[model samples]
Target: MSTKRDIIEQLEKNYLFAVIRGKSFQDAFEIAKASYEGGIKNIEVTFTTPNADKTIEKLSEYFGDTDMVIGAGTVIDDITARIAILAGANFIVSPNFSPSVSEICNRYTIPYLPGCGTVTEIANAMATGVEIAKIFPGGILGAGFIKDVHGPIPNIELMPSGGVNLENMDTWVNNGAWAVGIGSALTKDITSDDYTSVTTIAQKFSDKLKEIRSNN
Candidate 1:
C-alpha cells in the first residue's frame, strides 16, 4: 500500500477536498454529493459531526466507484483515527498536531493532515513526517500568514481551513496554499429542502475555483 504522504500527494494534485461538519450524518452525505457534483473528488467528514464514523462508511460506499476519497476530520488521538480509518476513511485530519495520531496513520498508510497555526506547530507536524498541514481559522490568519510561513518553510504543503470561502479561495490558492478545506462556506444549507440550490452553490464554488486557477 502507498504511504499516507502518497495519498495526500494525490489529493493535492486533484486540487480540492470538501470538508463537511454538521449535526446530521445524512445531511453531511447530501452535502458531500453536492460537492462531488461540483467537481470535488475528495471530502472530509469531521468527527464532530454526528454519526461521523457512519457518515464515512456511507460516503465510502456511495462513492465506491469513483476516485473520490473520503476522510475523517477533527481527529485528536490515535484511537479515533484508527476507528475512522477502519471504518473506511482514506485519510485523517486533526484540528491539532498529534504525533501519536500521525504515527497511527503512518502505520495504516492513511493520509494525515494535521492542523497548525504557528511556525513551531507547523514544524512539529512536519517533524512527524506529515507533509500536508492545515492552517485553521484562515480568516484570522489570512493568506498573508501563509505566504509568510512559506518564506521559511517553502517545502511544507499548507492547506487553509476554517472561514475559507469563494471570496477568499483564489487569494489562498494564489498565496501558496496547496489546497483549501472549506466547511460552512461550501456545506452550509446544502442539505436544505432545495437540493437544486445546494447543487447550484456547490457548482458555483467549484466553477469559481476553476476560473481562478485558469487565470493564474
Candidate 2:
C-alpha cells in the first residue's frame, strides 16, 4: 500500500490528470489505457459514468504495480467516497467540499481534492487537512484566480479542472497550478472510437507540460 505522502508526491511529479468519463466500463478502460500509454500517470475516473466503481477497480487492479495513480472523481458524498475507496481509488475528488467526505478520506489515508471557488472555501477545506483544492469550471476562474489565491495562501496547492486545453495549460502552470485536469479535451477522440488519437493527444499534453516545466 502506498502512503498518502507517496501518492501526493506522485501527483505532483506527474502533474497531469486525465479525467476519464465513458459510457461503459470498457470505454473508460480503453481511454485510461491510451492515456497511460501517452505518459499520463494520473487517471481520474468520474462517477457520472455507469459502473464507475467497477471501472476504477479494473483500472487499479490492472495497473496496480505501475506508477499510474487511479482516483475517483465527482464524488458527491461520504457514501460515494467510501464506495470508491473500497473499489481501490487512490484519491477522492468532489465538485465541492464536504466534511463527511473529507473525514472518510482522512480515515482511509487517501487524498481528498475538493473543489473550491473562493479563498474562504479553500481555507475551510485546508483547515480540515486538505492539501490540494480543485478549482472547478476553471475556464471561468482563469489563471488570474490562481495567482490571486496564492497571493495570500502560498502553501495551498490548487488544481484547475474544466476548460483546460493545450493552448492555455501553460497559463495555468505559469500561475502556479499544482496540476490541471483535462476532461473533454483529453477524451474527445473517444467519441469516434479512435483510441490512437486519444493517445496522441495525451502525449501532446504530456510533452507540452514537460516543455513548460523545463522552461520554468
Per-model C-alpha RMSD: 1.7, 1.0
Worst 10 residues of 1 by lDDT: 187-196
Per-model TM values vs. the true structure: 0.93, 0.97
Model 2 lDDT per residue over 73-97, tens place:
9999999999999999999999999
Which is the leading candidate under TM-score? 2
What does the lDDT read for residue 169 in candidate 1? 83
For each candidate in the order shown, give its overall lDDT on alpha carbons: 0.83, 0.92
lDDT of 1 by residue, 91-186 (tens): 999889999999998889887889889999999988888888899877788888888998999988888888777887889989988888877767
Model 1 root mean square deviation, Cα atoms: 1.7
- Any runs in candidate 1 off by more than 4 Å, and if so which? 1-6, 190-192
Q: State which candidate has the highest lDDT.
A: 2
The 10 consecutive residues of candidate 2 with the worst lDDT sum are: 185-194
